[model samples]
Target: MKSIKFNRELCDFCGTCVGVCPHDAIELLESDLRITDKCTLCMNCVYICPVRALEELDEG
Candidate 1:
């Protein structure tokens, strides 16, 4: 399965990922976005974030 990972260094704390996640899987973490629930692995948040803060990881 694919999973979402947050690049803390790249995040701008804009909350863009929180609004883009259709599954409500992400939240703000100390001003940055973090995965807070079950993620659909949709990659929407990854693509929508202006800073490219989110990444899709394959669980192997």
Candidate 2:
């Protein structure tokens, strides 16, 4: 399966990723961004995030 990884250092908690992810895989945790579900690896969040915090990882 594919996955999404967030660069915590780059994330500004702007919530831009969460809004772009159609799978609802992103969320806010204690003011920080978090991945709440398995990513479809569509790269939508990665491309939409202004901070460029999200990444796609192949787990095959």
Worst 10 residues of 1 by lDDT: 31-40
After superposition of all CA atoms, the RMSD between model 1 and the true structure is 1.6
Tens digit of per-residue lDDT, candidate 2, span 1-60: 677777889888887777877888777786567676565666888889887777777788
RMSD of 2: 1.9
Clashes of each: 0, 0
Q: Residue by residue across 1-60, what tens digits does model 1's lDDT show?
A: 677777888887888778877888887878666676577677888889898878888888
lDDT of each: 0.80, 0.77
Which ranges of candidate 1 are over 4 A from the true structure? none
Instruction: For each candidate, give its TM-score against the true structure.
Output: 0.79, 0.73
Candidate of highest lDDT? 1
What's the lDDT for candidate 1? 0.80
Pull out the clashing pairs in model 1. Answer: none
